[model samples]
Target: MMDAHKLDCEAAESDCRFIVQSEDEGEAIKLARTHMHEVHGREVGDDELREEYLQVV
Candidate 1:
């Protein structure tokens, strides 16, 4: 997990900022909105976020 976090930390600032959060739900929800609109074409809800955050972390 530390290694993964390190890898993320090494990323270019723009890329890191694009994917990171401060445990901030409001920002995450906005990201989900963008993903749903431009990528998945499905609604993104809290349940999906909980599961994804678990896996990524």
Candidate 2:
């Protein structure tokens, strides 16, 4: 099994209330990217999301 991960939109300095938690890193990144685009109006890459936003929880 994969470790659980968390991604917070606030970590990127936005006021978005979206937070993603999943055992699948790919799902977390995918959701985060969609949220960022739908809510924050930004396009973030996977590497950036993984390095800056994704956290093990």
Candidate 3:
């Protein structure tokens, strides 16, 4: 089994310290995108999440 995929909001250079981890990368990205939009007012996309925030752990 592989480790869960991880994403940290701090990676996007935001002051918000949001972090998400899941076996499903899609889920992580979804949660991150939602958090960014609701809290930070940014509509982040999958490519940007994969490139800027996604981390393999």
Candidate 1 C-alpha lDDT tens digits along 1-57: 231211121232233333534355555556655655564455656565544441233
lDDT tens readout by residue for model 3, 1-57: 977989888877557688899999889989988988998888989999898779989
Query: What order do you get sorting by TM-score, best first?
Result: 2, 3, 1
lDDT of each: 0.43, 0.89, 0.87
Better of 2 and 3 by lDDT: 2
TM-score, structure 1 vs. true: 0.37
lDDT of 3 at 48: 91
- In the predicted model 2, the residue pairs found to clash are none
Model 2, TM vs. native: 0.88
Q: Model 1: residues >4 Å from true position, as ranges?
A: 1-23, 54-57
Clashing pairs in 3: none
Candidate 2 lDDT, 1-57, residue by residue in tens: 668989988888566677899999899999999999888789999999999899998
**Segments of candidate 2 deviating more than 4 angstroms:** none
1 or 3, which is superior by TM-score?
Answer: 3
